[model samples]
Target: MLAEGPLEEAVEGLDVEIEWKPFELRAEPKATLRPEDPYLPEIWKRAVYPMARRLGVDITLPTVSPQPYTRLAFEGWQFAVEHGLGDAYNHRMFRAFFQESLDLGRLDVLVGLAEEIGLDGPAYRKALEDGTYYERHQDALRDAEAHRVQAVPTILVGDTRLEGVPSTAQLRKAVLDERARLAASVTVEGVVCRADGTGCA
Candidate 1:
């Protein structure tokens, strides 16, 4: 997705929406903590952040919450990735929790971030606690599994699947191709209308 700027631009006028999908963060088997292991948060900052900005999408990683129906983990990831917030926010949260050793799963931290970004912190926090988006998250996870996405940063460009970090040229080509196909199928027309159901130019 990050690699296809040209393609996206080529089809900019067409009414189309790109959907991003994120992978689940399964807990690794317990092992002795290695100080030398690269921090997950830093890795994301260095790798995923820049590309995500270029792609103009967000990524979301849903952690287990105490809420009820608001557990839309997978869907949240998709939404985050689509909105380009996944890397920026998630990386920050992950760093706070894993590297800096802060509790990222806490409501206060999440709410703080929401506030910082001018999102509805209280509402979003409540949703997390209440599991308001749980179904969507679960559904997204199922979709990811069905698509065999076993890693982070998977790019789904139409029928083409590119996994891991892709080059700029590759991404650009994909975007262009996607736009071309969409443009080929749809045509725009102009129409004038009056409130009284009478049409005029």
Candidate 2:
């Protein structure tokens, strides 16, 4: 939901298969946050709120950070993805977390969002209660570690790794350039990096 606008446009009419791998930012398994967590203010002041404003995103960060690991929400996301409602689920969750100041780290909050997104709420509740997708969520966390993803909006086209949010034009160019490079490498048989993949770094 964060970079959906540009990313969706970037891959438009392209034969790119995007894989959404979720990851956690918390260092520990059970991480809780307070209103005065010290780091939150810095991130909001220096990065998040500014980026949101620049992107014209509607977000209202919480005064008191929720206590509980985000893995619970990620597990619910696993459920949403499996049910083919990942997009709606993700967007609503974003709105809930930021705009509505909902605690996504809470199972009840996640269940409510799932229901709002037309998913089976009770089943999702049970899944969270029983820890059904904990390991699956952990797998995604492992994949994030493998990719060295310390930030959100970490996009990869072929071998090009794009970190942070890129503008619609910038993302579109990246997608087009990558498409051209792949096509040219196969068709032209001479130019390997015609689109300056190095610049994408």
Please give the lDDT score for candidate 1: 0.54
* Candidate 2: clashing pairs of residues: none
lDDT of 1 by residue, 47-138 (tens): 76666766664533222232112123333333444445664555554444434444344567666755554456566666767776666776
Off by over 4 Å in 2: 13-15, 30-33, 185-201
Q: Global lDDT of each model?
A: 0.54, 0.78
Candidate maximizing lDDT: 2
What C-alpha lDDT, on a 0 to 100 scale, does residue 168 get in candidate 1?
A: 57
Question: Per-residue error at 127 for model 2, in Å?
Answer: 1.7
Put down candidate 2 lDDT per residue, 87-129, tens digits, no spaces: 7877887788778877776777788889988999999999889
